[model samples]
Each structure stands twice: as structure tokens, then as C-alpha cells.
Target chain A: MKMDVIQPFINSADAVLAQGLECSTAIGSLSMEEEAYRRKGVAAMVWLTGDIEGRIIIDLDPETAVRVASKMAGAELPESDSLVRETACELANQIIGNAITALNDQGFHFRVHPPVMHMSEEGIKSSEDTEALVMCFETPIGSVFMNIALRYNRKRHADAASAGH
Target chain B: MEQFAPVKRSKDGQPVRYLIVDDSVFARKNLARMVESFGGHLAGEAGDGLTAITEYDRTHPDIVLMDITMPQMEGIEAAERIVQSHPDARIVMVSSVGYQENIVAALQRGARHFVQKPVKPEVLYEVIKYVLGDDGAVATAAGAGV
Candidate 1:
């Protein structure tokens, strides 16, 4: 994926964590993985269309999910509670919402579906040829895992579009 | 420093009733906390747009804080339906999707105002006051958090 696409998600996640949760987050090491992503305790998927045809996956363990939810709720909640799961989804939604705003400001028109939660045992399996950019953030609550995997190989088109059309 | 005086009571001595509609419990609870802090009562709560419509009929709240993305029906649709049935319904769109299209659509559908999610207390307070025509509390939201 292009830096333009990946950087916004990273910046937005940082902003959302700091502004929304009042917690400063530090960026962990980054890695590129070309493998199927097995969903952990909770995963939120935001599908993108228009200029970007792919999805952004945010995964967190139950402990991290509970901590994040508790902070957002201003009260502690058990991992089994439905509200915890909703909080996970909302976090992803807000982060992507911010990212979309940045992308749109850069003249990239992309529409995102409402963030959806996946809790089934079966995890998300990326296509074999897809290269996923995995970025990790260490927050006061816990670690946040973001995977940016694009199915479209439209780098040239995106590059031309970014050239101030 | 400007302190928020308690809402005390409305000029008519009646409590301002609010119905909060959101799919997230965190959102509902947080907004409810804000309402109570401002001396308003949460008349009811709905997790989706469909329930919002039914709850609107039953609760008849003075104001509605609606979330745009929901499973059954979108917030705009619900606002339209409520406005169709009761033209005086005071509905506000509170959403994370701050996209222009969605915001414009909600405003066109009879929503009195729009406030993006991750809402600050002062912004919400200002919006609710403005929508309810409470000019006394209609100060600019900026610098009020201090």
C-alpha cells in the first residue's frame, strides 16, 4: 500500500487514542506480513470503496478490548459484556472516520462502511498475494494492532491522482 | 474560570426530557451523563433507529440525540419519519461519520442540528440548548471546557 493510504490510518489511530481516550500512544515496531490474519479476541473491519477498494482490520485481545472499553465508558466492564464488543467496534469506527476525513482532504474520495465486529472463531484470511502492513501501538490501556491490506493493485493510478489533479 | 451552573430547572420549572438513540452503550451512557450534568432527564434510550421511532412515540421527549449509523434504520430515516408524524420533533444527529453528504442529508431530513461524535460536553450542551431554544445556555462551546 502507498504511504498516503497507510499513514492516515496510523495518524488517525494516534489522534483518536489521545483525544478520545485521553491516553498518549507510542508506535511500536512495524512489519510487513503476507499471510492470513487470524482474528484474535475481537476484530473490527471497515470496508473501503471508491478510490480505495480494500478493508482496514483492527484487532485486539480481550484484555485490551476490556481496558479500552472501560476507559471509554468511564466504568469497568467484563470482557463477556456486549458493550465491550461494541466499544471495540466504535473505536475502530472513530479512527477510520478521522482517517477518511484526512484522505478526503487530500482529494481522495473514499466511502467507508460502518465498522463491523467479528468474534467468530474463524479469522479473516487475506488473499495469498496481498501484502499487509501491520502497525502496532502501545497505549495506556493495551496494544492496538492495525492491518492495512489492499486487494487492488492501483498504485500507479493512486500516484497520478495524488499529483494534484 | 467559567463554571457551569447546574441546570436548576427550566423557566417553567419542568425538566428537559431527552431521548438518546445509539447502538453503543458507551455512547448512550456517556450522553446520558452529560444530560444529567446539564440538569436534563433521560426520558428513554434506544439502541437502533427503529426503536428510536417507537420510543419517540412512547417517550415524547423534548429532544432526541440520534446516532446516524444503526442496524435497522439509519438516523436520517428515523428523523424523517418522526418529523413526518410530528413536525415539531427536535432531533439532533450525533455521529462519528462527519462526512458532508451524511451531514447535509440529516439536516435536510429535519434534524435541528448536527454534532460529531467523540462529543465534548460543552458542544453537546450548547447544541441541546440551541435546539431547545434556550438562548440562556446558547453560548459558544469553545473555551467553555476550561
Candidate 2:
């Protein structure tokens, strides 16, 4: 994926995590993944369709998920609490929604689907056109992983190009 | 959560009733907490736009905190529908998506204001005050009920 597409997610994650956690966050790691995604713990996946198409997954270890949920809730929550999973999904939704908003302003129209729990252990493998880029954001609470796999809709691009001619 | 001076309806000095609409229960809870800190009452909650419409009719809240993206029906359309029936309805679009187009669209469709997700309590408090305008009054610290 081009930096233009990836940058928004990075910016959104950093901003959202820092603000939500009330602490500074750093990019712990960044790498491209071509293999099928393996969920680290509680994962939430959000899909986008329109000018861009594909999905983004936000993953957090069970412990981290609990801590993050507790911090956001301003109270202690046990690991078994369903709110932990809900927190993960809401975090994913906020991160992806913010990123999509930035891209939309840059002229990419998209419909952001609601986030759902990524129940499967392994996710679909990335293709050449939509190679996944994984970014790990290190916050005081824990490491938040954002797996982004997206591509411009070539047909829409071509249509826009031809229509402009 | 930091407490703000409670805002009450100018007409009755009662807590401002609110309808919290969002697909995520976590998000709804968070917003509920924030509104509570603002001295607002949770009149109702809805998981989607369709329910939001019904809840609006049933509860008749003083304000609506509506999420933009949701299953069944989106917040913008729901806001429009609510405003069509209740022209004086105060609907605030709360979502993670804060793009110019979405903000403008929501405003045009009858939203009183827009607040981005990962909401800051202070900002939302100010927005509630602004949106309520003359209809809302912030009670003095001694008189604050919440």
C-alpha cells in the first residue's frame, strides 16, 4: 500500500490511542505481511467499500484488551467481561472511522462498515493488490496492532479517468 | 470523570434529557457517562438508527446524541426523519468520522452540531451548552444538582 493510504491509519491510531489512553504513544513496529493474518487476541475487523476496498483489523492481547477497556471505562474490569471485547471493537471502529474520514477529505469516498469481532484464528491472506501493512502502536496500556489491507478500486479509477477525458 | 456545573432546562430547571444512539454498547456507555457528568439525564438509548427513531418518539428527549455510521439505518437519515416530525429537535451527530462532507451533510439534514469520536468530555459539554442555547442554563455551583 502506498504511504498516502497507510499514513492516515498511522496518524489516526497514534492520535486516537494517545488521546483515549491519556498518554503518549510510539510506533513500536511496522512491517508488511503477505501471509494470512493470525489474531493475537481480541480482534475487531472493519471493512471499507467504494473508492477503496478491503478490511482493517485491530488486535490486542487479552490482558491489554482488559487494561485498555478498564482505562477507557475509568474502572477495573475483569478479563471475562464482555465490555472488554466491546471496547476492542469500538477502538477499531474509531480508528478506522477517523482514518476513513481523512481519506474521504482527500477525495476518496467510502462506506465504512460497522466493526465485528474477528472470531477466526486466521484471516484471509493478503493479495498482491492489497498487501497488508501491520503497525504496532506502543502505549502505556499496551501494544495495539493495526492490520491494514486496502487498495484503490481500479475500475472506479479508470471510470473517473475516462470520464475526465 | 470531571464534573461540570449541571445544565438544566431553563423552563423547568430539570436535567436535560438525552437520547444516546450508537451501535457499540461501549460507545453508548462512554457517552452516557460523559452526559451524566454534564448533569444530563439518559432518557433513552438505541443501537441503530431505526431504533433511534422509535426511541425518539417514545422518549421525546430534550437532545439526541446520534452516531453517524450504524447498521439498519445511518444517523444522518435518522436525524432527518426525527427533525421532520419534531422541527425543534436537537440532534447532535457524534461519530468517529468528522470529515467536512459528513459534518456538512449532517448539519444540512438537521443535526444541531457534530462531535468526533474518542470524545473529550469538556468539548462535548461545551457543545451541549452551545446546542441548547437559551433553552439550557448552567446552574450555579451551589445549585448544581448533579
**Top-lDDT candidate index:** 2
Candidate with the greatest DockQ versus the true structure: 2
Instruction: State the lDDT of candidate 2 residue by residue for A58-137, as single tens digits.
Output: 99987898888778877787777477688888999889989989999899999999998888999789998888999899
Model 1, B26-108: lDDT tens digits are: 77887887887776789999989899999999999888999887777878999999999999899999987777777888989
Candidate 1 local Cα displacement, residue A132, angstroms: 2.3
lDDT of all predictions: 0.78, 0.91
lDDT of 2 at B103: 98
True-vs-predicted CA distance for residue A18, candidate 1, Å: 0.4
Interface RMSD of 1: 3.3
Deviation from native of the Cα of residue A163 in model 1, angstroms: 18
lDDT of 1 by residue, A1-165 (tens): 678777888998898788767879998868887766667567888888777777788888878887887776666767775665776788887888778777776766766677787666665566664578788888877888888776543774677769964
Query: Candidate 1 has which clashing residue pairs, if any?
Result: none
lDDT of 2 by residue, B63-134 (tens): 999999999999999999999999999999999999999999999999999999989889999999999999
